[model samples]
Target: MWEVFLYINPLCSFCLKVEQSIIDFTRKNNIDTQYHFVTTSNMETINDYMILKGMKPCDLEGRIGVTQDVYDASLLYKAAACQGNKKARNLLMNLQQEVNTNQRPYNDETIKLAVEKSGLDYKAIMTEKSGDAVKEAVKKDQELACKMHVEKAPTVIVFDDEDPTKPGVMINQFGSETSEEIINENLIAMLEKTMPHQISEPKSKYYTNDSIINIERYRR
Candidate 1:
């Protein structure tokens, strides 16, 4: 019963792991949540933004080198998002893994391979590169990142916008939970407090520092 603004990239294994965990948690617990993934048609620009953020401009394998023009890659991500399909998420996730794990000198074929493995309509995703829908969606995402202060990948927030008296927001701090269990533990309690639902609540002693969220390389 909370609106979770999960800012994540598909390529990040950490992101993938966290996402999978969250999905599992929701299904097992029957929690109502929403995901806001920023990938697909905005690939190139986000990468550029990452480079601008100082990620070495190359994958761990050094396979894909950076280009002066990042338009195509940026469009790849944003355009995929516009399609509003799970395939787009798959494409971005596999693409991220490809760049992160592959060897150096990544080229068109490797990218194509990542796309194929993701089970997306490669032709459709490619065609979307030139379409206005993807371009506009990418812009919107960028603007959103700016407005929402998401400067890092995998930015997660647990929020409820129903309170009317104070009706503000409670931000979550990352790295607060001592362990994975603690993370889920605290999340359940917080969710109940915000939505008052029947769920397995975590121990609240975890809030010693009174922080439930963390901002990683994310700046406003």
Candidate 2:
């Protein structure tokens, strides 16, 4: 009954490893989990975050270099999310896998393969060029990420159904750690500690109202 949201960017080596770690942890522990993939470019998001945190834009790496192709791919990911959950997760993860694993830029063939594996028509998703849809999806996703206060890639927030109000803890760069076993153990502990009670179940009588983490408190 607990929910865990994994904010990830597939292109990062660390993120890819974290994804694998989560998968292994879930499989081994028999946990039901949900992954919310953040398709935004980390550098751009970080720049915005720094500014929001009252940091100066002068410190940002705008002129340092960012390819438009990556931005385009981000939009594509948002578009996928809009269609459905299954399609979105599959395509988003697969595309990220392809992009991260590849040494070259985004290729039609690679993207197509990712789409097909996701049970989608690669050509149709590619051909649909509705500006508003892509724009709105990307905007909503960015807004959500900002609301989540995510500062980096592959950051995970674990929630316990029993305590629903308090999210247990979070982890950054779960994958590619020196010890994968340790990482899994830590995640399992967090998962066990954070899961919230389901709506079908009784609410906690001990909730003092002081320890609850109100999701609405998050500022955009």
Candidate 3:
């Protein structure tokens, strides 16, 4: 099994796209993957970062001026993760879809909708106790992001299952002007390099040399 640490923010459109691409890639390749979601910022300062990244502040729907609400969403995600990985992922996906499509605010109402969408026990996971634990988890993830020098959203770190001491390879799709296929191909190439023997026989359709070359060309 491979561990892929994905640093993401709820407001980042690029992160949303990249995460889905990774999920699709993993599913198609039949790769056993453990995904860790990490947040890089709260709502307080994310707007400035968005502008810096050449994105509109309004792209996140109800996220523009809401201070710490996005962080609250991250906490909600962590609380869901305590129940199970699938629940957590579903909540995150639901929240992202709401924000990107419906322009829903990252408030308690949105959290409720996400919980319902994820099929999680709302009363059980939305307590003060779970909130405290989620706060700590979010703090830990932020610290880990700092240690890894992750300054952008949608940063993926692929770790080798056998070699614990070796440094992991990081891949980012934040500022890339290329297509999602190229970004996914580069990410798959990095994963292949990390775990050479673990890849299955039938390759994913997106994993191709031409895509890799196209990504390199875009970089140049």
lDDT of 2: 0.58
lDDT of each: 0.53, 0.58, 0.67
Which 10 consecutive positions of candidate 1 have the poorest summed lDDT?
164-173
lDDT of 1 by residue, 20-123 (tens): 65667767777676555653214443564355335754564332333322345557766665556466666666666676556423456766887778665667
Error of 2 at 139 (Å): 1.8
Q: For each candidate, C-alpha RMSD in Å?
A: 7.2, 7.8, 8.0
Per-residue lDDT of model 3, residues 1-220, tens digit only:
6677788885555677778887888888777887877767844347644564466778766344443656777777777877898878887888888876677766778778878988988887788325566788778877877666666566777765566655566675333533676666666666666666755334334432211111111110
Q: Where in model 1 is the C-alpha error above 4 Å? A: 39-74, 101-106, 159-173, 176-186, 189-193, 199-220
Residue 95 Cα positional deviation in candidate 2, in Å, after optimal superposition: 2.0
Error of 1 at 93 (Å): 2.2
Q: Count the backbone clashes (under 3 Å) in each candidate.
A: 28, 9, 0
Clashing pairs in 3: none
Q: What is the lDDT of residue 105 in candidate 1?
A: 30
lDDT of model number 3: 0.67
Distance (Å) between predicted and true CA of 76, model 2? Answer: 1.8
Candidate 3: stretches off by over 4 Å: 42-49, 52-67, 128-130, 174-178, 196-220
Question: What is the alpha-carbon lDDT of model 1 when measured against the actual structure?
Answer: 0.53
Best by TM-score: 3
**Residue 67 CA displacement from its true place in model 1, Å:** 9.0
